[model samples]
Target: MVLFVIGIIACEKRLDEEVFSELAPSTLFTSEKGLSSVLNSSYAYAHRPGFQDSWAAYHLASMTTGEIWGQGGSIENLWLSEIDFTWDGNHDHIIAQWTIYFNSIRDANIVLDNLDNEEFSNEYKQLTEAEAHFLRGWDYSELYNLFGPVPLYKTSTDDPLLPRSSESEVQEFIEQELLAAIANLPVQAPAYGRASKGAAMAVLCKYYLNTKQWQNAADVAEDIQDLGVYELLPNYGNVFSIDNEGNNEILWALPKDATSPTASQAIDALVFPPDYPRPNPNNIVFAARTYLYDDFVNSFDENDTRRNYIITEYVSTTTGEIVPGLGDDRSFPYKIEFDPGAVGAAAGNDIPAIRYSDILLSRAEALNEISGPTQTAIDLINDVRTRAGISPLTLAGFTKETFREAILQERGWELFFEGKRREDMIRQDVFISNAVSRGKNAKDYHKLFPIPQVELDANPDLVQNPGY
Candidate 1:
């Protein structure tokens, strides 16, 4: 395994020169250090800022799904309009997300293309090649989830023009790449941010669940559990705490540290109350919805420990008085609580990409789908609930349909504000209906986002998704 030294100089140099150099891949892949440098650049792409502004995939997915809403203001309105479905293909965030994921895929392909060089040791080649495949699979998974079917670039090429692949084809590609990744990756990652066998399996499991391959999803999820590399953290709130990073529950995370070049947690800056004490006293306060929806908040049992992560009211740090979270200025997510020493957006908290709890829930849902409400399924769901300090559930007499809805609701409660709601709602076939019920101008075509007008103009071969 290549021992990655944490430094920006080498990675920056590789990224700067490799993309434009005709002979860089041949020269770089011949040496272990050279190949490691290129792989570092590919890994860095995972943490690149998604949207230019505070609006990111985390915010977009939550806002569009009605789990949150942007507080209205002049600067905020720019992205909020698009997020609320008022804008179209020309939206900046839409274009930025498309660019970010494609760029990541481009970098991953570059690493993959150089892996077969004869000079590299067989073990090193296998390790680095698996990492490249994992990164590529991950990028494609994000692209497929957000934009539906995107162009499948299997190798690094100078050609920027490629037609979009079919949705099934893209899913199949992701599945095959991740399977290859799983075969070579270790059960646990050697480093904090690196992907592992468990991480690859997690993504593949989700893919199966999305495609309604119940048995495959269940089997993959079960495989992860059997690996014994991860387990749920005892405290639900501690899962997101900066001090608790690399905990047993985290399967994969984007490593963020105060000293790193990319060293901030935007979620904290985006979801804090306006009057809350922050490192910068003048920092703009970004809130979630005016409230977390009465039904959502009410769904939790009174004893649920997870409720601590959602603040409905709090004592003002400046005024030393209680503040009510109601009306337009409502409850905000406290998952990314606060880093007392953190100033501006620089916090040491790592962003979780996949967690053990998610795997458990996926297993439960998949099992339920395959065989109504089995005890194994109920036990998995109850495991998550039990961690949240709620009473365990029993199969009792639930129909297949009722059990499916129950699992969906369980996912919402467990994964809210983690950027999984929109996809979950979409898979459940309630995305449009849910939006309409919440008083949005959502249409059936809105299910797949527009292919971004800029992309359409740049690539004549590209076809836009329906309704955009």
Candidate 2:
């Protein structure tokens, strides 16, 4: 990780003097090489707080979404808050998520604020601006995904008492930032992990979809299709393979190092059973284990290639025999690609931020919302279904409502454990009801997480969500 001290207000509960340190007038900005030295910090900080970590990715994203939960593990107690829909401002993961996104946003702001230095060459300035805008937009979108509209800080701020923006206000901000990114971002990023025009457009689609702007969402998704730069890999498993980290299907992914602990993902520890043996010697098991709800795993069709990734049974390392993992130990979520060799749960699997399949699904749903079930929508859905080795749905299948239901289910199956579930259920208007159906005490206000308690206490100007 780059250790440059750029100007940023670290999004902690408390504001300290060091949080407002400046990046200007530094010798590091005198040359292009020096500017490049500090650029990785933006990507590193953004990627670190999301996909590479389990607290925000699995705990808040998947556990609350009704399909997945933890069983016997050290972190099971922590998982209960989200699993039961009892999370609040005081929840540890909620607080961490709020801090995480803002920290990443601050990183982007630091880079953006310094890009204008005359000492630095203008050759790379435009790319740097696009990258910063993309990261900021991505960070804000994720923040809006969890809490409705958080305290909006477009630039680095010494005053940490900014109030939360309105939902429409935040949405417009994301749209503007993404549009700017799309204008300058290259069709293909210079590097695998950098932001591209496709990434920006997909993110804009997400912003529109989440805001229920169907026309805008569908239009942006169509724009991505026109790019002709992305496609689904023939095999779903290989899409996430360490060997295919930046494959054609992926619009954006958080790059992970195979051997670096801080630079890799911990999915194996959170989802795999401790005693289960892995095929590769490098993929060692960790103690943390999350269970696949029996109902959800059973919901998958037997022919689904996607279901094969969810291990219902596994060979126990200690016993040297196949064990009933489904109702016994725990069915593991093996969706995130595991590295053949790495330390503990930190594997080289680059976490996907968005895939071409997501764009296809988004366009289909948006079209469905705009009109009724159209042939175009069905064809788009089939593209994803064909890759999954499942039977395609014809136009004669059903009415508008049924198609919507099918789209939601397809997304649940295809995007499982990729940090999209929580938002998916909410957008489908089933997040709270789905939990209530499963005996959780979900309330209307539970749709959005509360602002972190520390932030509220620190800034009285910040208003909390409807319910505490």
- Find the candidate with the highest TM-score and give its number: 2
Q: For candidate 1, write residues 1-468 as lDDT tens digits.
A: 342222112332122212313334455655776667667666666555322422467755776888876554443664476456775788766676787667667767877777777778888888888988898888888778878898889888756888998877898899999999999998867565777899899989988887788899999999999998889888898899877777889887766553343435555665666666555553435543233655676677899888777777778887978787643336767776566545455554667878899999999888887878899999999999999999988889898999889988989888877878888888889988998987888998887778889889999989998877
lDDT of 2 by residue, 171-256 (tens): 88888899999999999886766788998898889888988899999999999999999988899999877776678999977776
- Which pairs clash inside model 1? 290-330
Candidate 2 total steric clashes: 0
**TM-score, every prediction:** 0.90, 0.91
- Quantify all predictions' global Cα lDDT against the true fold: 0.74, 0.77
77 in model 2: Cα distance from truth in Å?
1.4
**How far off is residue 65 in model 2, in Å?**
1.7
RMSD to true structure for each model, in Å: 4.4, 5.0
